[model samples]
Target: MRLDGKVALITGASEGIGAACAAELAACGARLSLTARSEEGLRKAGPGALITPGDLTSEDTRRAVVERTLERFGAIDILINNAGIGSYLPSWSAPLEEARRLMELNYFALLGMTQLVAPHMRARRSGVIVNVSSIGGKVTLPWSTLYSATKYAVNGLTEGMRVELWGDGVRTMLVCPGYVQTGFQKNTRFGHAPDGVVKARRFAITAAQCATAIRRGLERDARTVVTPRSGWILVALSRVFPSLVEARMAKINGTA
Candidate 1:
């Protein structure tokens, strides 16, 4: 979709890829509605954006965000569901409460935002929905299995939405970013990545780079976007050699 003069509502706009997307989209001449739990961070992310700072997991917050954005922008031309958290704990032993909380933000909150905005888009018959998933969504990362699960769900949701919204002229784009240079590690809900995974950051791409890729994908109406592009190699390997991929992931998680 052409972003010029469009209104884009982006969640988790406080930092990292979300923040970068806010800037990138704004640069593309799209009016911005930025939201996150940190008002201060949102301010820095989009100085001229419509800011709605709150926990997206709360139904009230979600309603207020959508209501306020529509009030200000008249319409939401694009919905970027980027608010999510990670869990580094082993899925088998992770606290159930923590897992549920992670799912609330990463999955449920995204669905809620879509539910609120999709009707408006459907009526207009024009809009783009961008769901920020992870490469781990396509190929499980044993070190962050719970996080992977949430992204896997996101992938499914994005794909289904694409088909369901096709007749309406609404587009859904799934973004699978490999290790990004963000505060993701420090801000995870709980636990730390294994040292091997931490070291892999040296090869990670910047949030700005990922944001640029997202914008390019939208311009071309791409169905699935894998930032760094090379991440597709891993995804392909996982599909063609599942056991080999699983063994490598197990070694990364120190389980092999």
Candidate 2:
């Protein structure tokens, strides 16, 4: 369905992909609850957009965001679980607390927001939940093991949730994309990636392109949307030939 009159909540809308998605949905007439830790960024990007400035990892913040959406728009039809953070690191080099914190936003916040919004959607008998994961969620990249793991959690979660949520009139879309030319890497904690990650940075997509694909997916209510074209081929290969996919990734990591 079209997003013409719907209300949507998108986390991490201060910039990057989240910002672009908010712009796209708002362009389609969806009232927006755009959230991020940067209040200034939200104000600058959104201007007239409703802003929720807080760390979404907090349960209180998550609840407040949904509540505010309900307050302003009266109903929440679309929940875009797009806020994610990563500290480029290997399993050991990564700080345990930092990894846990990342999971809090990338995994827990996503689930929490869905739980808060789903009942309303179920009662209303229609809604959409778009979980923005990554190509890294589908496969591990060197120096980004912890980030990959968190995304893997999201990948599994949205899949199982989609099956159970389907009959409730909630459609879940898991968006897996290759590297976007966003500040995702620069903004990352970089647990041990002092030299930087070469592999992931190479095959980069753009925020605008990613947003366009997401809009089309939400419009048609597609199950999963992959961007940069090659993403589809990689995902397809990973499903049937996981070993091969990992092997290919291993080679890429070797260079990184």
Error of 1 at 219 (Å): 0.5
User: Once all C-alphas are superposed, what RMSD does model 1 give against the true structure?
Assistant: 0.7
Clash number by candidate, in order: 0, 0
Tens-place lDDT digits, model 2, residues 1-256: 8788888888999999999898888789888888889999888667677798999888888888888888888898889999998766667766788888888888998999888999999999899889999888886765578888989999999999889977889889999988787878678765545343545566677898899999999988888888876887877788899888777666655651
lDDT of 1: 0.94
State which candidate has the highest lDDT: 1
Candidate 1 has which clashing residue pairs, if any?
A: none
Report the CA-based lDDT of candidate 2 relative to the real structure: 0.84
lDDT of 2 at 137: 88
lDDT of 1 by residue, 125-171 (tens): 99999999999899989888999999999999999989998899888
TM-score of 1: 0.99
